[model samples]
Target chain A: MPRTRPNLLERQRRRLVVPFLLPALLLYALFMLYPAFTTFYVALTEWNGVSAPEWVGVDNFTRLTDDSLFSSTITNTIVFTVLGALVLFPGAMFFGYVTQRLPLGRLYRFLILAPVALSVTTAALLWKFLADPNFGAVQKVLRAVGLDSLASVELLGRPNTAMLMVVLATVWHGIGLWMMFFAAAAERVPAELKEAATLDGASSFQVFRHVVWPLMWEVTRTLLILWMIQGLQTFAFIIAMTNGGPLRATEVIGTYLYKVAFASSEFGYAAAIAVVLFAAILVLTLLSQRLTRRESEQY
Target chain B: MNRRSLLRATAVATAVMLSLTACITSSDDGDEPETESSGGGDASGAPAEITGDLEVVSFYPEGSPDFERLSGLAEAFEAQHDGVDVTLTFGGGQDVPQIEARWRADDPPDVNYGFLDVTLPDGGPWVAAGDTMNLQPAMEQPLEGYDGTWEEAILPGVRPLISVGDDIYGAPESVTTLQFFYNEAIFDELGIEVPETFDDLIAAADTIKAAGIAPFTVTGTFLPYMQVYWDYLALRHFGLDGLQQAIAGEAELASLPGAQEAAADLEALVADGNFLDGFRGVDFTSAQMSFFQGDAAMILMGSWLIGEMAAAIPADFQTGTFAFPTVDGGSGDQDGLFGGTNAQVVAAKGQNPDAAEAWLQFIADPANQTAYVESTGGISAYTGIPAPEGFEDVTAMLEEGAAFAPSYMGVLALSQEVQTAYQQPIAQLFFGEIDGATMLTQMSEGLQAAAG
Candidate 1:
């Protein structure tokens, strides 16, 4: 086909597209693409943020293979994702389903999401104090229930429980958003299908398991992938609460990288860790997308 | 609730909290001494050339007394030179990261805070990296308060920390040491004498424990404090040379002759269960709270603890400071103190070298350094200053001929990666997950890899 000049309207729209999209593209390129590519180059060198970078090829990545700290962070990150998914998805779905149909649903939703209003540090501190062994609410409650010995068991002090405490705080801070996500998806479900199932003598659990659950499945899968990403990149709670301590039992990729870069000043090494993390997240997310892909059900 | 009742309840709650807080925090005798109206007064001796915009950064957060003290110094420097505008930036725990960012951009800050210790493998990080200027000249230069040079004015033990051979890279502001801060009332109540030896200390700890009080409070969360038990043990057992042998990769700490005994001593310390419950996860701040709140009878803390926790100390709480007791059969200098110096390091490639150097020299003046000690509650690096208020005993202790070794735990001069990797196994050792020998082996192996 011979090229032809665009009509006036088309020409005007094409001119508008550049004006509209150029700023966004420029910003994304500057803040994201530039740094991303720079980080790749940095990962190949031994740079201490301040000094000129010395090229070290694949040494950093090679070192990571046997690095105990790197392996622990990777393990902990995976644990965070798996444990978080186990607690978050089911709990979110259950509450989201119940809240949508329950009386005073808005109030329930508001109460459930109240923690979201608190900053991560505030929420972490709140949870930390609440679990204090001596004067915390957990101790008071445990003592009230005659679990006196257990009351003094420091939840955040021990290695296993410290990590668990961080995870719990993260979940408390985040569960609300995921719950609201499921709630919105449930709201979109056709009322007729639920009514039909109830009339067909389906118990509430049965109705949920067969009807509502299947309806929310698409949202569930999408949110699961989202939660996994959040879990992988978790940082603030660990820093504010445990600081990757109690024998570094709570360390994850994000916190480790931050320490490596900022504390140790090994920006090059940290960049290597970051590049690997980015690659892993991208590959996993794509794989998740493929694995979760399904034909949409026509109503 | 009714509005009237709500208001009444709020007032009552606030009053209760106020009283409770007062009963908990030690009396802050006074706010910081007023800055001289004469704009830093007459500089004891103004440097010949100090006219420029001097940019200084500190880890002390703004509004903190330490930050205010430093700000006062900068203002003083500015006053000395009409043309100089001293701008001080505070980052609390982030000064280094910020400095590095500025350095990467090729516009480094003129002066910033840092740790300067000879114990660092190559005279600390910036000096090792050659990013800091040699501060020996600033130290050797005459200042108003001293009969001789500023170098002679500094504590003999601390003078070596900033030097790598002939070069000095840090202008130190304070001497830091770890000591036991105990509740005086508890010690008196038990008729327990202040322990001068490790055995006596252990006995006192037992007595305190028998009274159902936590004998000590130390946080496992702060990796530095977590290493203290091992640090003192290693020093006492192996002496400075033997301890340095491990740090320098010449030997494993566990392989030393005194290693077994020191391990036993640590095992005893750990086995005693003298520390407050849940100490592992709680940070240094909480550990301090546990002590000042009277939950723990004693706490081994750095010199900054008093100032850091001044507000939390109750007026009635008699905070007693004592040096770490001497170890029996110890080869290390019994009177030796383990600490580091906080310095204001000028960048080698900074824009205003003269201003920064002069600012540092101004800081080194005896009167100025004395002001720092008097204003901020810490051990001053410069000599001839009275101890900080409430730290008189500590000052007297240092005056009695003690050696000072910069803390060697996290300041290993190794990469943070290696230090963190090394610390994990040590933490595991202290947690009873690994034996002392295993810890030494792991640490040695970890450092050996980095060394390679």
Candidate 2:
């Protein structure tokens, strides 16, 4: 095909591109790309954070085949991400649509978002204290209701209970931000469409399923990807609450790699884990982008 | 855009990333605080006439007594040298990474705490990297504060901690040991004798439990707290050398002599419900709080626990100590001390080696170490110094015939990775989710993988 050369306006625009684009590209490469490439290189070496890095190509990667810990690590990461999506997305969507039509809507919004404002450590610690087996509010409430059996549940010791509490805290701390996105997206879906559907005897559930779902899919996809990325790399909540304990029940890639790097001084192996994490995130993001592809609904 | 313009932009981006990379990573271009020079001449200080700017750094938080003591030492060194200026840097809690970043740039503090397990937390990695100065020559000569050479001044068991081969990397300041700290009121109420052997200890725990109190409490959230349980047991079981060889894979871990009995002893304590409920979830501070609040009768902790928990202790709380109970029929020394030494290290490429050495010499003086022990509420490495007033029990355990051992888990002079692997299975083992044989096998395998 014969290429059409740019005219005066296009040429002038192209001339300004290098100077304007250089700074951002440099920043992106330095902070993002450089570290990423470094991780890939380091993964092939056997380096402690202190000593010189020794090349041990594919050794760190191959260890995943037999590393029982990595299997649990993957399961834990997926549970957090998948469970978080189930709770956060639906809850956010419900609240997003409900609050604007309710009295004291602004107050409700503020209250839900309050957990988000607090630091991650603060929020996790609050949850930990509440779930503390002895004298915590969770046990106190269970006992107050006279359900003694449930009161005996050790919130953090058992594998399932520990992960359950962590996920609950994560959802409580996270949903508010997504709710804001949903509320905004819901607002953009013209009221007349819901009203017409209601007048035609469609149920609220049907209206939401058919109308709101399509309009909000774009935002939802992005949120899901963000949740996946955040979930796979969860470190703070596990470290702060359980420290990957009850015998590695809640270990995730982020926490595991941190232990390998700082605790074991196996920086090279840590870097390898980091590389795999990066690849997983990239694949999931791309897959989500592809699966969510659709024609834009022009409201 | 034309192809040439697009190519040009890519080249520009690459150049920017390349050219500014060094500038971004550089640790210093005059970021260090200007040296607060005392102008050493004619000042009333030591006779040393060293002339240079020295940087001394510590990882202690500002306003901590440790940091204050260090600054005081730095001030004294400045006064003594007359010609040298010393800058003391406090890392607040982020000191290790901050110091390492500097070292990566080939610039580290002139003198620093090595972060030894016995002497300082987070100590070995720097020494393993060969970043610290070797103190052998200095150890050979007489230091003014002690009657003997520097090496002789330090208690015998401590030197091996910071040593790599024949070269010693850190200067020992003080040491500590582990003993049972009992709530005297509780013991008196329950009529429990101070436990002298494993049987007596078990009986004491049973008595305490019968009285509706948790007999013992430990930080389940912190692995080292649980892992420390194995230290005395394994020490008494395999004895010191055997346990060491077992951990190092020189001896068969499974066939170690006292293994079965010690394992039963450990599992029985938990199975009998002798610990606080939900102990595994309780953190260090929480466990200590439980002990302090008198919810638990006793806590197995280090000698430093007193100083660490000083602020939290109640005014009328009567705390008493006894050596960790000896295991009957064990091959190890019955009165072996369970503790480690703490030390300060010098950077290999410090600006003024002589001044750094002089500063350390001043620190090593029996007077300063004595002061450290007094203010820090711990035992000094300097031999002649008397044990701090309340630490007579710890000192008595340090008697000539008594054996000394660092914590098997916490300050074991092993990599944290290997230590963590050994500790991770303890929760399962303690919860009775895994048996003794399984635990030992898992631990050996874990150690191999960690070491690999």
Candidate 3:
């Protein structure tokens, strides 16, 4: 049978979709896409945000290779990303599982997630006071315990410990959210499957390893990507706590980008750093997605 | 309906929407605020009657003494100029960024309170862009209710503090000199006379350390405080011109014999454990607390330290300041002092230039300057203004100094990258993580690269 043409009303409604979408699309283009494309162009120029931008080809990128600070920042970003994943992925999963089996689990979850309610700056400030070498509670406790030598060590001052301290603060603030995510995923696991496995003499650990873990793969993968991105973009807590000090010990890509742009007024160079960071995040995300991709299982 | 009619309707709708969007988002070129003409000139060529809303922005937040004093000044200016309405915007610590955004948006405040140096990028956006009104014209005019020309009324040392080339962009509100602020009680108890030479200073530190108290305390996390020591040492070793040359990339910092000596001296200070325990980790406030609480015997800070720690200072605590000591066999002029100006500028593109100039002139007036000195506990940039009673030592030191050397870190003459290059290494030097030679080498290399 010959298909009838769409009515004028239907055609009008169809046409309205584009116009309706145009406002949001225009906003997205104006705010996000435009700045993103501009950032790429800016990466190749020598703009100080005040004067007109001067095109410098790949000069900024070349400079990046020689920038010791940029190299160190990259190293810092990688370390944070890797360490964050190693800590959060399994740590969140374990806590989620343990809390699921415990009495008054809600209280435990509430306590764990409390830090998430505070702003990164507030949490950082709180931790800074706690870690203060002279009069902080940690130092006080250490001294009280006759560990005066340990108490004397400035945790946030030394290069070896500054970054770690920042990361720990970040984790303390973030682990709750990750745990909640995993808990929700764990809740969705087929209870019948676990019960059947238990009936088959499979231990709780065995059931979790074989049944629960496999089912939670998709959630875990998504969490890993999110954690990786968050880790790469870490800035506020470090800025509040260290401001990339103790000899640039806690300098990360995010802070370095800020310093380059605002402190040094090298917008072009900063743009280059930002572009590299964006690309790094993009590549890692895409690679992780590919590796984590799997055929849908009929459970 | 037929397909052809439907297609036509769709095209019409698309065209209508496009036009509407274009019309809604179009820029209004005609709506730009008209630049008001200069107000009618008085006998002195200054505005006869300053009128209009003058928006003044400051880094001083509300509730602070500086803010209250400035607010009073604004009220006084308003009372004097009947037609003018002075609006003060307090930005806390975000004044620079706020002013920059306003300038970019073409809505800058009539007046801006900020640091004078354009070299330090964070001071204010107007200096680098030449957006501030050239104060030379205003400075030549006699200050209202003052005894001399505005320029003459301003302290000679502070005249050049706010200048770029021959053009002065801002009027200094106060002058701050950096020196060792020691507890007079501690010094008297320890029998450590104010060190006159580098060796004597080191010996004093040794005696203080032997007494089981840190000789010096600094905010190592805040790189600028660490740089203060390094800067004074460099100034003592190489002199102002030599250090300036090094900062300008005309000479390598490490290669300069004076720089090497300064570095070695700094290393010696570190090796002697002069700084507070775990100083590398301590922030400015913590370090300040340590000094005020007597955990540390002395602190190297600006004159503003008194104002900042006014409440924190113990009731019986007597503070005394000494000039950075001379280094034996050093090339630097022994009488040079490290300090800078806290100045205010009028935005060139502001709507109320006439009123802004009037406000600046009023601030420069002796009575207001005196009030600022008293309220802020800072040294006035206006000449003949007496230092506060408790600050006689700093005043005497300032008077005795042969020349004022702008702080190395505060001088934006060197790019921040170059500054950071030395700053981090200086931290290492303090921590004994890197030697003085290594720190100097890094500085020299960084300066060379920055120059290129």
Chain B TM-score of every predicted model:
0.81, 0.82, 0.86
In candidate 1, what are the lDDT values of residues B52-139, reduced to their tens digit?
5767887677887777877877777777777888887774563556666765444677887663436555765556666677777656
The deviation in Å at residue B387 for candidate 2 is 2.0
lDDT by residue (tens digit), candidate 2, B20-127: 666655644445433223333221233445787888776566676667778898888777767677887874332465776677566777777653332333445666
- DockQ scores of all models, one per candidate: 0.20, 0.42, 0.42
Superior candidate under DockQ, 1 versus 3: 3
Off by over 4 Å in 2: A135-137, A140-148, B1-95, B109-111, B115-125, B141-144, B349-376, B396-403, B409-421, B444-452
Candidate 2 positional error at A211, Å: 2.9
As a whole number from 0 to 100, the lDDT of residue A96 in candidate 3 is 92
* Global local distance difference test of model 2: 0.75
**What's the ranking of the predictions by TM-score, best on top?**
3, 2, 1
Candidate 3, B446: how far from true, in Å? 3.3
When candidate 2 is compared with the true two-chain complex, its DockQ is 0.42
lDDT of 3 by residue, B291-322 (tens): 98998988988888888767687888888888
Chain A only TM-scores, each candidate in turn: 0.94, 0.95, 0.92
Tens-digit lDDT string for candidate 2 (A154-255): 778777788888888888998898889899988889889989989999898999998888988888888888888888888888888888877777888888
Q: Model 3, which residues run further than 4 Å from truth? A: A1-11, A297-299, B1-52, B62-65, B75-95, B114-129, B389-403, B410-416
lDDT of each: 0.75, 0.75, 0.79
